[model samples]
Target: MVGRVLHIFNIFFFLISVFLGSQVQGRSLSVKKPDPDNAAATARWLVAQNSWGVLNTISSDLGGAPFGNVVSFSDGKPGKGKGIPYFYLTTLDPSARYGLKDPRASLTVSEYPLGTCGKIDPENPTCAKLTLTGKFKLVDPKSKEAEFAKTALFSKHSEMKDWPKSHNFQIFKLEIENIFLIDWFGGPKPITSDEYLHPKM
Candidate 1:
């Protein structure tokens, strides 16, 4: 009788342990796959939503590389097609001038704070931002590319016409190759092109 009782007890404990293990495994899977989150699409979404972003370019001068500057962008207009961004900049614009001199450049658009103003935990920093790495090439102002850029600019910022114009003004299209979205500090595992466009998770 005692042997039978112990056998039943062993089976019950085994089932209970298995149930707990399964729950843990399920939670692990959920964490690995953050819901409704496609990093590439989300990156494009974040950039589309914001009108302004800081652009980083490589300088040809003897000084240094990775020069950062604030710039305005417009996406998806009558002339400018989707999946492309247009910017209006002058030769006086250090980044633009340097980019013209050296076509190799990487643009970073982020939720640049006017000044950090918030109350949050020190260890867990929370912010919504996206960073894009790609090359920037200047386009002729009178060319077909320029027409698209102008239309896109006017659509996004109607007041752009009021600003002083320059012949050196050029449009740069970022050939995005990588995107980084950060919800916390130290950077999350970047969603690659394949994973983002067609997530297997």
Candidate 2:
């Protein structure tokens, strides 16, 4: 009879522990959610309607920098494919070469609606944007991944198909280590991977 009572108590304690654990997890998710009109959601939304954005790279010394290069981007997913989050670039492009020399780079995408100031200001609610900071590397041309990158790029930027020796194209995968999301007039906040995936916006 003592053994039976002990077993029952063990089962009861296990059930209570699971219930408490689930509650904690739920609270954690809720707390991490950002403002619905902030930077986190903006990153995901940027990829939704457009396949292009500005790729920014800063030298290790932070001496040279440029903005808005009109580069094509992929969500690392092949339309309806898994979301791996990558970008296709050409080594032939001066920007790509700059990036190769300085692997420390960031990609900034806008979330402004059609028209209105794309600039960020406290009053501008439409000025939501996400800047991803990470290390970038050139994709091996002979690899199968390059084949998919080419197909995806050509599909989005048909003009690329007409360029001669486009085989020199390189895929740059920005292994995102951090995301800085900004809202008009709001200080930028560092977001976690979970927050990046489910941004409020």
Candidate 3:
């Protein structure tokens, strides 16, 4: 009888734990996501929340072929985003070198990493993804924009501040000319650079 009682207790405890875990997951998914109808707001939210993305550029060394690299970036400090993604890159890396030879580039970010996608597949239309295509220009180290870039980057990624200075890291910004956003099943939303930069949200 004692053995049977212990077995029942074990099963009861397991069920309780599973129930609690599901509740926690549900709460995380409940985090507010911008309405899909608000194209500009949704695009801005994706850029503002994501810290890293795939940055694609024209490769100078590879006969001008398309090259993509994983990069960390920041739009602004926390909730105050300007909708322009800023990156800290070193010419020691191919992406920065490629950007110098050809400024055309794009940055792609997905909502999956944010943990708000719930059980949806990442490729699902409702999961949302954004790509900002534009010129990748280096920010003059002596310029005011460079200062803001440093603060913005260091604020989100503190380890960047302590990275080796010998690497000669520099700030780069994507001068967005076009924006492609997919947040729903219909298709990509139409968002202009002006609308994305000046979102109502």
Candidate 4:
């Protein structure tokens, strides 16, 4: 009876160890967010890590009201982000149409999707959010930049490559002029387009 009880205790201990190990592994899989004080790094990190965000544009059909649409974007290949958001868009989508009418737009991304914000409400200031406001321009399909953009977009979103070619998906990029970042409790961080695009090494 003594040996049997010891064997049962060992099994229970082994199970607990496996459970704890899995929990640690799960947490490790999440990307580590940058320091809140580093606004440029934080903003770039948000853009690089997130696969999609809400792109807001001035609606041409809605009497010039602001309209936000969920869309997929890529800054660069994984870990090679240039800090500029590139998108695969088609005029069939209202966002592409609105952007063509009025190039002014903003792309907003949240750190919540990265799974680094543990137990924090998405709206909570500490959750970290970034918005890049600027002119939305379409890249000429034949240009070298467009080639890079296509690679960036297709790499991040594989389905984009197999998307219906009839839809005429064109490459678009935001000419970031201003940045709004909220990573901590005080208020939105004051980061300029230049600062974000060219961070100090």
TM-score of 2: 0.61
**Clash pairs for candidate 4:** none
Q: What is the TM-score of each candidate against the true structure?
A: 0.63, 0.61, 0.84, 0.84
lDDT of 2 by residue, 1-201 (tens): 999999999999998876685454321111222344555555555554345667777533346755336677666333332222456666665667777887777777655432223355633544666677777777687898777766656665567667666456556766677887665454775567676666554
Off by over 4 Å in 2: 1-41, 59-63, 66-68, 76-86, 113-125, 183-186, 194-201
| Deviation of model 4 at 157, angstroms | 0.4
Query: lDDT per prediction?
Result: 0.61, 0.59, 0.88, 0.88
Sum up the clashes in candidate 3.
0
Rank by TM-score (best first): 4, 3, 1, 2
lDDT of 4 by residue, 1-201 (tens): 999999999999998876785454322223457789988989988888888899999998888999999999998887888999999999999999999989999999998876778899999999999999999999999999999999989888888999999999999999999999999999999998888988752
Candidate 1 local lDDT, 1-201, one digit each (tens): 999999999999998876785454321111221322455554554455556677878767747667878888876552223545678877876877877776665555543331121454322334456666667777666798778778877777667777776455567766667766765556664867555444343
lDDT of 2: 0.59
Clashing pairs in 3: none
- The residue pairs that clash in candidate 1, if any, are none
lDDT of 3 by residue, 98-186 (tens): 99888999999999987778899999999999999999999999998888888888887879999999999989999999999999989
Give stretches of model 1 more than 4 Å off.
Answer: 1-36, 77-81, 111-126, 140-144, 184-186, 192-201
Candidate 3: regions farther than 4 A off:
1-31
Output the lDDT of residue 95, model 4.
Answer: 98
Error of 3 at 19 (Å): 20
